[model samples]
Target: MLAVAAGCGGGGTGADHSTMNRRDGSASPGAAGHNDADVMFAQMMIPHHRQAIAMTDLVLSRASSERVRSIATQIAGAQNPEIRTMSGWLRSWGEKVPAAGAKAGGMDMADGMMSDADLAKLKAARGERFDALFARMMIAHHDGAIAMARDEQSDGRDPDAKRLAGQIVRSQTAEVRTLRGIAGGR
Candidate 1:
């Protein structure tokens, strides 16, 4: 199901230790090779990504056009693996990873996470309404991710985590452009 957008180019599970991520899941807490910025990036982005995945799942069936569904698939393909990768980093760092697949909540709207009411509205939308709302919300969501990735690039100490942050910026920034087009420049 997540492989639906295999060719769309959302980064991977940080499998390439040579470049994107150097830390392995087996590394002990003392050997995590990460700083607080890396930990915060993993902790925050994991749930952020989960929320995006949840939205994609909802949109796939209800989207009026094939294009929207395709984007949803792309997002899931990219993010689901990244979530696993981040969770692995957290575990290696001896941090408490949020429960797997936790729905987005509690984060302030300024952080770009949708509130319960927003999710409920999205859940209740249909046809073109869903498409428009999704484009708007996802663009906002992607912007949030880009911001966090930028923070990691600035404050994170691990080369692997910084590489992953760069990947996130590139991918999600592109997604924001596409989503803007989908939103008719709104």
Candidate 2:
């Protein structure tokens, strides 16, 4: 019994402790849950969504048009939950969520994000000008999201991840049209 207990102790040889299955039922070490596609999608997307939300918040604070503010609120609201959902996926997969400041630093659509200068410019504008800028910038941001979503849809193997990407594409495409109309350019 002592030998058995000792064997089960610090240097246990029954099984590899390093490759144990997690409580969340992700997978054993030898198995893959999501994949690099899922990891890349989530990692790249979180900050992209964050930037969109930041833009939306800027307009929500000083937007003159009820329509624009309403749209900004909606965009922020929808994307916030999606960010949490994607983060949850990363957590379940035992992956790290990328920081907002982390450079996506890749050839992906996330690289097309707005510069700090652009955000500063947005923060400085107001009234019809602000509406115009917000519409134009958000249109571009939505386009970037659509591009990323399309990539995920094409490459992602996970069913839920692909479905969410499709949702982002459809919803953001519609929003692009709506924002363009609001910008008086449609």
Best by lDDT: 1
Worst window of 10 by summed lDDT in candidate 2? 1-10
Q: Which regions in candidate 1 have their CA more than 4 angstroms from the true location?
A: 1-24, 28-32, 101-106
TM-score of each predicted structure versus truth: 0.82, 0.78
Query: Model 2: clashing residue pairs?
Result: none
Expressed as tens digits, the lDDT of each residue in 46-112 for candidate 1 is 8888888889989866778666788888888898888888877667666778786674343555556
User: For candidate 2, lDDT tens digit of each residue in 118-145?
Assistant: 8899999988889988998888777777
- Provide the overall lDDT of each model, using Cα atoms, as 2-decimal numbers: 0.70, 0.67
In candidate 1, the residue pairs with backbone N, CA or C atoms under 3 Å apart (3 or more residues apart, or in different chains) clash, namely none
lDDT against true structure, model 2: 0.67
